[model samples]
Target: MALPLLIDTDPGIDDAIAIWLALAAPELSVRGLTAVHGNGLAGACAENAIRILEAAGRSDVPVHLGAGQPLARKFSRQGWGVHGSDGLGGIGLPPAGRGVDGADAVAFLAETLVQAAPGSIALAPIGPLTNIARLLREHPEARQGIREMVVMGGAARENGGNATPHAEYNFWLDPEAADIVCQSGVPMTLVTIETARSVAATPARIARLAAAGTRVAGHVAALLGAYVHDGRSDALFDPLVIAYLIRPDLFVRIPAQCRVATGEDSRLGALLWREASEGAPHALLQAPDPDVIFDLLAQRLRQLP
Candidate 1:
């Protein structure tokens, strides 16, 4: 049977790719998509999540709108220069309106985890830690209800930050929330820029699938085209997390200690870790292969309706 999972995201273009991978691959049964304020606003992220799913013709998967801002920081939008105002990289898509019955993301997360058999549900947070943090805060007991939580955030040794010099976007958005999640101690795995940056999306690779004439392939192609920044090819960050679920073999892992800083400017969103530490909470991955992951992603994207 497919593993039941929840995807908490911010719907960046890469997040859109991640959603495609989750829905296309049969290994994961997406219980619901919870939106947080990250690559875009909560309203746009929520709409993007549903739009991506609808584009793939998987509207049955519910989308939940989450927090508008972090716990401590005042809410702000990640400039459209990064993810575009629509979060789909300006890929023109049909209206994504609302989701199905009980589409409230928070409630769906609570109910799904509670109803699931112990250790059967996995939560993948690709955007920020807001919703996941809230889930744990409101349902500390539900930690056991989650079999695992695989998230895309943080930067480790040798890998710097995407949003800042030392911090990654997800954690940087709200270090306090990330801290809450890491300390919670539910089994967690982080896919950071140190690993995801290596997973490049090449023009040739993207063109192969874009020519397939499938709805999802075209959508992905459009996203990739819009993702080009300063003549450099785009990187599929979120899909690296999903790839771990579909094809874990593509990643090289090392168990290391990790923590998110909740301090003021220049320190916020900093993900710290040590390979040799007494009780470092999070695990750090040094390198992840993009070719293998993109190959898997392309194959899966081509499979969508």
Candidate 2:
């Protein structure tokens, strides 16, 4: 039985790979893609999601436009070093034949969860938590329908943030949204950059992906090339989020309590977590062996068809 999933993303380069993995892998049933503004504007991110799906020949999946910025924060310009101007590293991938309708994303999200089987839908967010927060706020009852939420944000510690030494881009972009989602108690699996940075995609791994003989693989490899030349060697960030859905056994899960810091200081977006005092597990991340995650990600990318 494939796990039904709804992806909320900002269409970064690694986000493109994540989408491909979701569409290509047999274990996941991707119900839809909801775009948010973080790596780029909502319009660009939504367009990129549709373009990536069509590139993978999976246009049947719907892509919905989401919030243009955080709930309270004014639109900020960030995530350029990684996502670049076009969100996909300025790579000129052609747009889809037609984008999704102009229906409001919050309504789309509420309707989708209401219609799906109870506790059968998984929400995987690879960008800001705006859409997720809105869903929780507007339709609190829909929380019962969620199986789990896999979020790619927050840092496990102060020094682990990718954007700042204290915060990751997704959380820093919208800490209020992260705070709301975390306290919602909707069974979430947080995939932090602390674990993801350890699973860097080496040159050889990128080469292997490019040689996989699939269009999706080739496009992902191209994105990897841009990332590498941009002075980063890891496609491990976003792919690990998708790869976790495909293969969870490869990572060691540590249930620890986590919270995002929303202070207007250098510590904003930090992930605060400690041993559970209430005798309950908190969040699971790639632990014990980070190398195991890199190996698993490479193996899965090689298997792309």
Candidate 3:
């Protein structure tokens, strides 16, 4: 049986690919998608989630809108440059065919997990931790239902950041929320910006799949094609979350402890992670074969539209 999943996201360009991947995967069942602010504004982020599900013909998956800004910080759109003004690289996919299921993303997250069987559901957060953090604070009871959370976040040390000199956008966008989730003591696996960077969707790779002549792949290629190519900005960061869920063996998991920089500065939203003692609940994940991951992307997305 497929493990049930709930994705907390912001529908960045790569986020669209991740949702497509989750829908295509046979080992997971997506119960819903909740949107937060990161790649774009909250309204656009929620709309993008709806559009993604509709495009993949998975409109049955409900979409919920969360807060438009971080829990303790004033909103800023500095991270919007990479995903473009409208996100999805501004390829202009049609507006969502349906509206969001409700106004509260945190409530949706808490209620869904609480209602599911204990340890039967997995949560994937592909954006800033705003919604997940809110859910954790408001409903600590729901944590018991989550089997394991696979999060896409943090800047790799080598890159410094995709957002700032010392921070990845997701963690940097909301350092307070990331800090809360990190210290929540929940079982979590983190996929870093480096992992996302390693599996880039370069023009060559994207074109090869676009030529397959399917609606889904072509749409994905067009959106990805519009990505701001700052040499390495077109990395498919979010999809790897789905791939990890399907094949954990393809990744190296190291037990670690993390601390987020919540102050406003160059290092704000930055995460400092260090290897931890044995059996730590938190881990950092890295992919060993990006080629195999790309193969999985092509094979699974080809199954859609």
Listed in order, each prediction's TM-score against the native is 0.93, 0.92, 0.95
Q: Is candidate 2 or candidate 3 better by TM-score?
A: 3
Q: Which run of 10 residues does model 2 get worst, by summed lDDT?
A: 287-296
lDDT of 3 by residue, 220-261 (tens): 778777663544276778888889998888989889998788
Residue-level error in angstroms, candidate 3, position 261:
1.3
Maximum-lDDT candidate: 3
Off by over 4 Å in 3: 228-232
In terms of lDDT, model 3 sits at 0.85
lDDT of each: 0.78, 0.79, 0.85
Across 1-305, the per-residue lDDT of candidate 1 in tens digits comes to 89887899888888888888889888999878888898878887888888888888888887878888898888765554676656677778888866534556666788788887888888899988988888889877677678878889987743488778888888888888898888887767888886776766677877876876688888888788767644433666888788888777666666666678877767678887667453444555544555566667778877787
Clashes of each: 3, 2, 0
Sorted on TM-score, highest at the top, how do the candidates line up? 3, 1, 2
Model 3 Cα RMSD, 1 decimal: 1.7
**Residue 305 of model 3, lDDT score:** 85
